[model samples]
Target: MPCRDLPPPPPPAHLRGWLDEAVVRADRARFLSDLGRRSLGVGRLLLLWAVAAVFVLGWSFIGMAWMAFEQHDPFGYVYGLILAVLGAGVLIPAGFWVARGARRDRQVRHLLHAWGESDRDPVADARVRAPGRSLTWLVTSLVLGAFGLWVAFAAAVSARPGDTTYGEVAYTMGIGQILWITGLLGLAKAAAHYRWAVRTFRAPAP
Candidate 1:
């Protein structure tokens, strides 16, 4: 037997607005996370490119300097070019400049997922500020890398001056030095990045 007339069932409430809001939020979070990841990747690549560039430049400088010592040739146009311009002007400044930037922009994003929101990151309060970790690596690594380049360049330059092939030799040596210096510097940066990454993104203890 059916009980007759309770009132008709309440009309169903609409949920489209709530659903849309949730979807939008999730999409924004994903986008931010992606950007954060991309920024990290780009920074890393730049650091490496800068390093390689330095090494190549250093190698060239070394070759030129070595030619200075060689007696096979006199101070030719080659000597003036390297000593005057590319070595002093380009590679040296480039090395220091890149290193400076690397040191400056190091940071750990506490929650990349909240990139879209004003203040919705789940762990917004848990951000751990990392200081000096990157700078330490940058300074130490850049110095070593730069020094290595200088040594390589100096070696080539100290070769007997006036070697007939001094021009060619010097050019080769300088280019090699620059490339090597850059590589070494880049390696140091990579190592530092790895270290920082390890620290910043350390897995939570169980």
Candidate 2:
């Protein structure tokens, strides 16, 4: 619980006909702190996912480029090169963006805590933040995950017959990895939000 003490100087005056400034400041700080923490967590996970995607997808394109040269397909090789460059190019800016956002969120959390009152009402926050319905997203994630699994299985099984080259295997496996990662991330987020929604909306015990 936050102390009801009025910390320091008075709040700004646009109009003095409003409620207590300290209470308003405390409430806003608590809400922003909560929001910052949640965003920070998601941002970290997203950064990891982004790095993983760059590697998986970038390697797959490299493999395609190699295969294209071996097959003497100029267009395919060029296309692969372009995609590989684009995919890898994004990582530099993406790294900077995530890092900057994470830093800002951390600063917000720290500042809010120092400004007196950081405790948040989870149930009330959930009512505002949680989705109304996430079932559709959940189902979509499941389908994507299943498809990714099938893709990976097919790629792995093809090696047993020695019919497909290593490059082909790498390309397909990379695609599968991308899809699998996306699906798992989506499912996790959607399920968590749905759970929060249920918990927040449930009737109070008698």
Candidate 3:
């Protein structure tokens, strides 16, 4: 007899529904895994940007303090020192907080990847279904918003005629704008997380 290609046996009818359900679950796990990866990347980038901003702006504040002291201006020195201290207090902790978040995200991504690889693993399935929240994002948003408010206040106080240099006014306003924008970005990320959680983990109504 000539060599022939044998037709594959069909799955039993009773098992079809179960197979389909398994496939659906696997697909959902894959989707969540991909979302987690993308979110991780975005979170890391935003956090790194915040850290960079902290160092740059923090140094600028110190430089301003030195200039004020050299110019024999008590008010200027006080203002600069206050801002420098505030920036150090807030931004340093914020940086570390964000860094910790990035590490957690990394671990979550790894777990998600492993879950994707072994779609039938019950442990992986449970891990995938667990809800998570990022405290770092929340804290960072609040911190940045607070800093923005302080900068705005400084700008207003420094705007009095003949009381401040043009550079000082411009710098304060510019930093304020940047801080507000970054803060809004953090809020946006938090909103994204909320939406994802609601969509993915919400219980179905009867």
The whole-model lDDT of each prediction reads: 0.49, 0.57, 0.58
Which scores better on lDDT, 2 or 3? 3
TM-score against truth, every candidate: 0.40, 0.51, 0.48
**Which tens-of-lDDT digit does each residue in 38-58 have in candidate 1?**
334445545565656665665
The model with the greatest lDDT is 3
Question: Of the candidates numbered 1 and 2, which has the greater lDDT value?
Answer: 2
Ranking by lDDT: 3, 2, 1
For residue 17, model 2's alpha carbon misses the true position, in angstroms, by 14
lDDT of 2 at 85: 77
Query: Candidate 3: lDDT over CA atoms?
Result: 0.58
Of candidate 3, the 10-residue stretch with the lowest lDDT total is 1-10
- lDDT tens digits, residue span 56-101, model 2: 6566656666666556577877776786676567646655765765
Judging by TM-score, tell me the better candidate of 1 and 3.
3
- Best TM-score goes to which candidate? 2
Which tens-of-lDDT digit does each residue in 29-143 have in candidate 3? 6555454535534445465465648755764665465556546577877886786686577657766876775665555544444334433445444444333434566677778
**CA displacement after TM-score superposition, residue 107 of candidate 3 (Å):** 22
TM-score between candidate 3 and the true structure = 0.48
Worst 10 residues of 2 by lDDT: 1-10
Checking candidate 2 for backbone clashes, the offending pairs are none
